[model samples]
Target: MIWSSASAGPTNTLLPAGGCTLLPRATMYAPRMLAAVAQESQQRCRFCTRARAPRSQSAGWREVRRSISSNASPAWHHTRSISTSHLPRAPLAPAEIAPSKRVIFSGIQPTGVPQLGNYLGALQNWVKLQDSQRAQDEMYLSIVGLHALTVPQKAAQLRQEKWDMLAAILAIGIHPDKTVVFFQEDMPQHLELAWILACCTSMGKLNRMTTWKGKLAALQSASESGEATITSSEASSLNLGLFSYPVLQAADILLYKATHVPVGEDQVQHLELARDLAETFNRHHATGQRYFAPPAHLITPTKRVLSLRDATQKMSKSSTDINSRILLTDEPEAIRKKLKGAVTDSERRISFDPEARRGVSNLLRICAALDESRDAHGWAELVNERGGGSGMLKSVTGDVVLAKLEGVQKEIKRIKGDKAYLEKVARDGAARARERAERTMREVREMVGF
Candidate 1:
């Protein structure tokens, strides 16, 4: 009764029994929210197209027949009903359902050595996921060097940055054996799939991306002020890559059939776009099957880490001021100096008001994120209880941050010393990634009639 694709070959096995399972009521409803929105599109939409039937035959059959009859178009009803008749009348209860293995994915751009914000915000989360992952779960963490090409870069500097990034990832506790950590540029299938997805994506969708808009606005400002490296005419053409890189990002996730993506708040939009493209591809190519599952966001606690110099802006490596951020490789003295000089309000009383007192709030957030035992508000209270002003707050926060980074800094230095081992790790990870990517591309090519 299983529907296997003859053209898909043995390696590209489609799920049996129409890929139906008794997922929890909560999990089942999550995809329905996406399906409801997708159905409005003019194109035929079959997102999360599995039928959810109950355990009782009379109730399940009635409900299954009703859903298949109502949700499907007139053209699909005959074929769908014929397929449903072969399925079991009684479905297993949610408690009886086996735990589904997860495919987790997240990537970071190889711009330079990771700063303290990167450590607390993303790298730490990556390590946490690795440590807590289920035995059957698969994890992919990539240094997205390809994504970095959207902006101008010297070849030598870019190469060095990639090396530094690889070291930083390992230093932060991303074990190669536990997680597939690879360079994005090493996998050509990423670009190959990106082109295919780009065709499925619409320009209107790309235009609405806030990150792309922000980059354009920044570029325009730089051009107006005559501070831009490229001429105004060149700037217009150069930015095309920036506008389209999100599609590549989508390819990165969908290529691996990733079910969960760890992303910051700002990157949620990109993840949504990936979901849309997954649905669109299924609608056009997979017939009635759900080929790609929409990835859910694993939003981290430390979503936004602000700059030390300017609380309004995110901590970024691109900033001209070195004091604005603390690098992972910074010595204890350097870390203490930066924390000491971090901008805060003149208020004698400490509070966690991000809007009114961004500087003080930023320091408190750092303390809370590092400690994990308390929140920003708790740290604020502790600072005030001890009658400690900004100086005491800075000193205590610096001590905690240094304590966290001390081990990571030493690990990074040790990892960076062994270039041969780093190369071997990259090669092995890329090989595994390629094996998986190739399996996907084969099915994709067959479905798309390539």
Candidate 2:
């Protein structure tokens, strides 16, 4: 199964029951107590947890109860940033394929070259799922064009951006043959499924969504200091897209009846909503076996990557400062510049203290995520491997980052030139996605007497 990262939605395939990690009930339910939080943050503390890291470092899943400034950085610039066609190459197929036993699905937006944060946060983990070769699993990599429509857009421009994003996905080694790669808008099933799920979804549930609040805050901060009052209408306008967008997302996962949804720590709340909806729908339909198997979620193994300029904030395209993030498609020169110019503490000594030194530590997290060795893969690894006495963490971390991204940079350049091929892939993917989605949608519609 293949997966291209897209927020919007994706294709369907029967994936084998691949190994999936789950949080202990205690972790999710009693997600407080500084000791518990500290222990969790010590291990895979995503960017959000770092800001509140405890004095004592801990490790593993008990270490995961954290939040983030959260991040994504593919919104590319017009300049000769990193182009997809010119860099080194990643494999087109995952290291392994699933045995026919279960199904799994995931997606990401093809904004541009994925940033280090995007890679570590989501895509890098996707590669691992591909290679697992579990039975009963079919993976789909979808370019969610429809989900991208939370805001207004120029038809011509968006169309091209989607095309560009698709190429980057293929170039990153998401096997076209193994995974269903397609555009979400091409399949009517997604919307149909979404509409059905929305009927069962509660307005109260939507209100609980953090996406709206986060976005409103972001907008407020971006506005002038004395910029009038925060009106519901202002927030309402921005809300149409990314905010009310969750029902569709729940539909996206359940449409495929996915057993597992790979997400960043920030997206867990949305996944929980999906799980809740699945249970509600099953009870309503009264099927012998559960219609949807309250899917499990797995966050990427690495600590979440944060902004290069500011650790308090997650890396994002929405940031007004262009320098805050390192776009995946950015040229080596640009990346080097960003890393070199990255904000660091005045003290020259490089250590993995995310709380006091966010800028440099962000760089370390990025490097550690893409590292070949286990010690560098997780956040607590920072403290575990050499927390007490520092080594060449900074310089070494820089080299690791450069090595990991080289392949992605090269692939993006090559794929951009083959737009025709990319289009075909998208079309074929849409056909496959639609076929699977219709089956799920048929049952959903019938349940509600559509």
Each model's TM-score? 0.79, 0.70
What local lDDT score does residue 180 receive in model 2, on the 0 to 100 scale?
A: 81
Which parts of model 2 are misplaced by more than 4 Å?
1-100, 215-236, 287-289, 374-398
Encode model 2's per-residue lDDT on 1-450: one tens digit a residue: 112211111111111132112232222222223233333242322322323223253121223333433594322111111111122222111112122354567777646456566666666666677766454567876767777767656788777777876776676677777778888778778887777677778888887888767776777885667667667656556755566577777778888877667766566677767766766666556341256655556433655777777778878766788778877787777777676657665554455666766765776666656764644335435534554223334445556667877888788888888778887888788888888888887777777777
Q: Pick the candidate with the highest lDDT.
A: 1
Residue 259 shift from truth in candidate 2, angstroms: 0.4
- Model 1 lDDT per residue over 1-450, tens place: 000000100111123354322222222332222121112222222535554433342222211111335565532221231112122222211122222777888899886688878887788888888898889989998899888887777999999989998999998899999999899999999999999999999999999999878866777788688866656555664577778988998999989988778777677778778867776777677763568755656644554679999999988887999999999888889988998889997777899999989999999998888887889999988898878689888987888888888898899899899999999999999999999999999999999999
Superposing all C-alpha atoms, what RMSD in Å does each candidate have to the true structure?
9.4, 17.5
lDDT of 2 at 418: 79
